[model samples]
Target: MNISYKFFSSHVCRICHRSINWEPKSPVSIASASRLYSGSPSPKNSKSEDNRSKEKWWSISNEWKIITTIGIGIASWFVNAKQDRIHSRKQMKMNLVSSQLKELYGPLYGNRIVAETSYRAAMKEYGGLRNYLEQARKERDAEMIKRWRSYVWTVLYPLDEEAVDIICKHAHLIAEKDFPEEFDTFLKHIARMRFVMEQWKNEKGNLESTKEFTEDDFLEDTNSSGIGGSKSMINHLQLKCKHLRKQQQEYVEDISVDNLTLGMLNKIKI
Candidate 1:
């Protein structure tokens, strides 16, 4: 008896609606088919594999983490140190300005006020300083001369001397970068008055011998172009004080801001 067989490469099942291969397969063909199916990965499997690859790529070693941490710490320390130096320098500047205002300009300004008040009073009583001295010299009235000498010795000389002493001691604190021209005139005025006073004392209140000493030389020049002008030393000092106070306030605000920033940084570090 002879048998005949018909073979189909693939056929669809009626009930399950699945395709089945009816061809015979060798081991090599079966393995190749299996590999082909696995190589074309599904969406779910691709995503999971990608996640694992990303985890490995982004992983940090322990040694690298420690090194990075130390680098950040050093950078933070340097920044804080620089800020501290800037703050300290500003504080020192503020202190110097305070000293200038308190030790030098403050006392000088006060003395000037008192001296001006006393001078106005003297002028009211004796019809101005230069005029009174000239009248006293011309008239040579013993009582008038004595009173004038007493006023000069008691009030004017002492005030001038005190001003000179203040300048001598605290000249470093003067706001001007250069020595003031007004200061030279003031010193000269004091020196001339001192010489005249000495001569008057030696001569026993005699006005005849000291005739060479003129009013311009022996008296204080109230109008020496800059003394009582709009741009006087007192005005300069007042302006300087105002500027310094503003600067000091700015320094304080900056320091406060720096402190606040440092505090926030410390919190972040913690």
Candidate 2:
């Protein structure tokens, strides 16, 4: 006999008024099982059980992982290569600076001393040295001035023995505290040699080459020309003559073979 239920409309069995259980379950066709049955809810009404099946927890695919690992490695390699290129460029710039500085050692050393003195004399005014160099470049080309200024700046940057000597040789200005005694002694010796040379001036009386004079005679300041007032004046005049001679010798040596430097010639006492 058919029974009616309050929730479900009618033709239900009294023992089990549930509509789905009272009616016999229908056999699903293959087509319906594949399509309609897949969409239908289960009689058990178990959603948690269906969700558990999806959480099977399987291992990741090796091929997908391989692709990801390879991709990361390639990215890292590119980044490293870019970094290496930047480092190479920086090193190249530094090397160029060092070479230019090396080639300019002699010239720069001289310019540095003069520039530094000018800077100091100006009461440490404006800025350190660039200011002084700009001031001195009125008559000269700016490039030459800059090179000289740069050289001076480099040598004066550090008060090492070699640098001080280089600066003092080319200019009158020197930091007394930084002067080298051995170098001074060498200069004095050269001056003495120059003095000794003057005493042996060409004589009219002698036919054989020229008559010679001794060191004691070379000390004479008999010339009365050009501020020849006192012993000091005579001494200064003698010194000037010697300095002029030394300079002439320098010009000759500069064009000589093997690029013989003024400093080297002086050191050699040539």
Candidate 3:
């Protein structure tokens, strides 16, 4: 019997009752197997990874945008609040200055001007205050003395009294922190003059007893003190009024500029 043995690629183990197969693999099939088991991603995985990357980018961008917007808003609020506080403070200061000017300095300055003008006119009429007083006293001129008394009673005394009243009532509105030396001197001068005038009135305008407190007494007091008889207080009042007016103007301009700037800022914010 001529029997041919055929080579088999597969065999079965009879004892285990299992088949064993030996197959040769091609390069294409090996590469495909490697791709399946390796770290390389599939099409579905690639699409999902791309979506995740896009989501991360968008999240980071949005977060920064939100943070920037919040920062700008907070900064703007702080700026506006600071400006408002400053404006309020300036407004209060301006009001106080206005009150001082209107109620105190303005009236004081005006009164001083009128008093000075009246004094100048009187001096021109009599050649000089001292000259008139001396001539009236030496000549015992009752009419001249009476004229002097009338001018004092009607003009000088009244004006000085009114100024004192204003000073007493509006002391708080004075620009200086302490009472001014010129003002104190003026008060003393006015008091002395009032005392002399009252004594004359009590004596029934007796020109004889007027020698006791002559015009020289009060006139010399005022000249020495540089208050009523001189230009000291007038200059002081004029300077104070000018300074206050300038300050008021400055405050007004500053407030106007602040308002304009704040309006522009509001528009920009809107």
C-alpha TM-score for every candidate: 0.62, 0.24, 0.72
Runs off by more than 4 Å, candidate 3 = 1-48, 203-229, 265-270
Give the clashing residue pairs of candidate 3, or none: none
Clash number for model 1?
A: 0
Quickly count the clashes in candidate 3: 0
lDDT of 3 by residue, 83-135 (tens): 98999999998998898888888887788788878978987967877777666
Candidate 2 lDDT over 1-270, as tens digits, reads 233355344333544556446543565555457655578655444576665655543224555677787787676566556655654554454444343333333344444345446536643663633444444444334443334324433443243334335545543332134544434443453345334334333556311121232222212221101121123322433443355445445544433422333223333210
Summing lDDT over every window of 10 consecutive residues in candidate 3, give the lowest-scoring window: 1-10
Clashing pairs in 1: none
Minimum summed lDDT over a 10-residue window in model 1 is located at 1-10
Query: Which candidate's lDDT is highest?
Result: 3
Per lDDT, what order, best first?
A: 3, 1, 2
- In order, how many clashes per candidate? 0, 2, 0
Between candidates 1 and 3, the TM-score winner = 3
The top-ranked prediction according to TM-score is: 3
